[model samples]
Target chain A: MTAMNPKLIALDWGTSSLRGFLMGANGAVLEQRGSPHGITALPEPGTAGFEAAFEALCGEWLDRWPALPVVAGGMVGSSQGWREAPYVRSPADVSRLAAEAMEVPTRRGLSILIAPGVLSHPSGGAPDVMRGEEIQIAGALRLHPQLAERGHFLMPGTHSKWVDVRDGRITGFETYMTGELFAVLCRHSLLGRLMPAEAAAPEVAEAAFTRGVEAARHSRPGDLAHQIFAARTLGLTGEMPAAALRDFLSGLLIGQEVLSALGHSAQADTPLALIGEEGLCRRYAGVLQRFGAVPALQLGNTAPAGLFHFAIAAGRVAAAGEPAR
Target chain B: MTAMNPKLIALDWGTSSLRGFLMGANGAVLEQRGSPHGITALPEPGTAGFEAAFEALCGEWLDRWPALPVVAGGMVGSSQGWREAPYVRSPADVSRLAAEAMEVPTRRGLSILIAPGVLSHPSGGAPDVMRGEEIQIAGALRLHPQLAERGHFLMPGTHSKWVDVRDGRITGFETYMTGELFAVLCRHSLLGRLMPAEAAAPEVAEAAFTRGVEAARHSRPGDLAHQIFAARTLGLTGEMPAAALRDFLSGLLIGQEVLSALGHSAQADTPLALIGEEGLCRRYAGVLQRFGAVPALQLGNTAPAGLFHFAIAAGRVAAAGEPAR
Candidate 1:
């Protein structure tokens, strides 16, 4: 049998979704695949279930490149996931994250390095933690080296994160349940019943979203709980169209998030880095700009690049690497 | 059959539950019945479905008291309910709510007066409205006439309301989705997964709840979305026990609501009137007191009494009427 060569396989395994990327040494994607079989989808906890799911997703690539190293992150490292990778407390850097990576044995004798999440504890308060986001943070730092000096990074998603980075390390962070709360309100609450069943067009939503952001900006920060009810009353009075209620809600929530994040720090005048999907990042950028903060947008997939960066940092991949093309 | 006589049938038909009261002329409850067949549970909308659910729950009582007028409130008066009773704009008094009541025809040739909800619009912001709570406010006014001069009333429920009363009229009000948000978070979000399935004991929960209130009091208002994530991280770090998460969440939400309410009004030092069920009102009072606001607690059922007050104000029953026992 001929010896096969590949640079690396990167995986982002969250609670309900998984994405796998096969990449070249130059950080170019060779192939990409995804599945709903995330860490939560495993039939059971432990190595067997993790191995089965991983094999189903990337076994063919492993068969081809028998010695290729695999890098993974996200909920797959939590206590509930395949193996518990203890969180490295912030202020954490790429080196600290790499040092805390846990190794798991695969049936096919392949190397799997799982990156650890970072936890932050404020003075005299409960702690906050993030897993896969740490990887994305690393990737963002690599792409925009200038961001390493000092900046706030906003990652929008379910449990959106606002991270404080100083000198290339995550000094501290906080999580906002903005996305998750939006989903719940839309699907399970009375406010959702008033919205149109289908989402409004992007342009229509963007306008309503702008109105929501403006409203949030003008209102007192504590009034968020009160302001949210406007989503219902506006529809009731025909002031806001029914189709636009969803976007308006999205804006209200995201606006509150931005306001809250700003309230915690005095960096509103400085440029804030946005790390996430293009659509969400664009929306967040719009809100931040409206709220008097300069927003610097970063688009594209960061998890795979982040995993690759982690692998290099951990010395699993050689510093000077080449594609096998 | 002889024309039967009673004071009035007071009904609280909300979105998800119904309560019917057979009362004496002096506002004494002679009989009471309730069911989960709220307006939303009606087999249909318009008159037909509402009649079916109403008859199923209170048909026998109505049959006996053929001449008794029925006063209904809550979502039963909303556009989605049996009939739409237009909202009376604030600053409105009990007389204004009574004047706006809409009468619907019934199979038994009886009059059913549905009281109107109240809507408040701040000069340049979105409007806020509440239905059943309007009746509760009227009842509170009757019980504590002093409140009519000037007072802020806090009604804790799914959509908690902070109402301002001045000079015998409801000047304005704000709605907070605190209770509803708590339910959604505990039942649908990732934070819920960390809480104990069963609720904690009263004493244990009280301590945790107090901690949550203190935490909220010290933190910035807009940080609630961020603060909620503590429920998960605390459990992860074993800083907070799983059984206590539910109460802790309850405290966090209620604390935010109280804080937001206080932020809107200049009457923080004045005692805030609490109108709701005993358990929830007690919790709100505790949080309010902990946050340095004086809480004036009102217990017992307010809906029925409010309905009777509306009936009297609307001249449905004579001012000097007596029960035909």
Candidate 2:
């Protein structure tokens, strides 16, 4: 993969981890690098931390490919980041993201363009925001143009994003703290106290999770707040094994996310394009399928391509780097 | 308050605190004492711990009135408590609780009767359980007989309970982890990280809380699982003051609890009874009023009344203590 001429170095830096992708001509992966140092995990405070972490992760690539343009996406561009790439409001597209990208110059003489996050204002509801997911959406659209003009994208992660793209521009999106909620509830809530030992055997996890999704599907919109108590009562009543408590909760939370996200949206029937780690995306796919949502696209790890796409729009990457449809 | 001769010792021994009421005839409080050593706050393990904590809280009263019947309610009767007072399944009433009270004798030559919890099984949903609130309900009903035949009770706390009573029985109930959820999110989640410094001022807390409740009310069901993100976004966008974030979150969580618990229940409109801490009860009462619910009763510290009511039904306390409605 390193044989191609490297064109751009892209980074998807989030709260807890940093991943770097060295892209070649036509958006090919020439090489890749990763670090535990996310925006929240800097070795030092301020620019020095970001620069040192950035250099440590892919400084060799930059040293060898002196002229290579570097770009980053995610929370790395937040206010707490090395430099704030203020959020660009929707409706947006890769071009708008490029236009809003904030350039931070480093001591190494290489200026990195940190992609801005997208903020969506829902009528009659509070505003929503996303950082790195927008870049992934850009890459998804670039790789699958059929999805460019119109698509429903679900990126399941610590903070899941259900994005809507209209006419090749990013229209709007909603955020569900599904992954985060699951983590906190398991680690902090009373129901969580019963999960650990019971979750040891993953054998019954599948069934328990499915049951949770089914329960979520059948419940009313406001039901999940109290309905979650089943994670404990069922175990106490000897109706469910303690071992399945963890999985049952995982299912219930994810199920509730899916139920709320899809049930209230008119565009749910549209084919969904999922972008995230395989396991989480699979869970969402199965749950979405439960709601009769047609499986559309599964585009994973589109960060490099997305950064390349954004850089191209920003006129940083040459058009020749764009892969043909 | 201690001038009257004490006739009974009633204790509300819960997870984190223990309150003992020295009662005279007619359920009058001769004196009262409290301790932080709840069923969960034992200095040691096993019966010894409960015995020690129990004695430490009200040993003088027990010694002064050795023949006075001792009665306790709350988690003290759970499997983790002094003894396992098996749950009396719904439809259950104070009589059932009295009938199911588990008695454990102490080395002090005195016997203590621990009140039982209630288990509610909702159709097509998971089972729900409450160890202490049932006693509170019994007390509430004893204090307001008008509600015994049919009433809706909201006991807001770490685990909020929306209980349904009919024909003098606890027919059903739902538990919402509102207080716990607020705690965990504020202490653990990303949104929580932005709360402390900004929440210094209490002046705007009321408005922020009201806004959160309004948002919860306007949101579709299932939306809360994600709608909670506004606690952060609204702050970030400068739409809401940072100080307001904490209360907003509190309001959102409590409001969501109300929305889900009451939205799906047919008995929600019934004149509602609010039981629990005074402040939390006030919050529930205010939110209930917003939903057009008729506020029926605000019975605080009903445990003494509840324990006495249960003791009477159990034939431990004399009928002379029964307060006439």
Fraction of native Cα contacts reproduced by each candidate:
0.71, 0.72
List per-prediction Cα lDDT, in the order shown: 0.83, 0.84
Candidate 1 lDDT tens digits, B204-313: 88888887887777767467788889888988889888999988888877877777778778976555788878888877877777767777656566888788888888
C-alpha positional error of residue B240 in candidate 2 after TM-score superposition, expressed in Å: 0.7
Q: Encode model 2's per-residue lDDT on B1-325: one tens digit a residue.
A: 3466776889998889989998877677777898988877898988899889888977887667778889999988988889899998899988899888899998789889889999988777788999989988988888888998889988898888988889999998899888888888889998977776645356589888988888887766567668889998988998888878989988888777877877767965577888878887888888878867767778787888888888888888776835422
DockQ values for all predictions?
0.67, 0.73
Q: Could you give the CAPRI-style class of model 1?
A: medium
Please state the error at residue A324 of candidate 1 in Å: 17
Candidate 1 is scored at a TM of 0.93
Candidate 1 residue pairs in clash (backbone atoms < 3 Å): none
Second chain TM-score, each model: 0.92, 0.94
> Candidate 1, which segments miss by more than 4 Å at Cα?
A1-5, A43-46, A201-203, A268-271, A321-325, B1-5, B43-46, B56-65, B269-271, B320-325
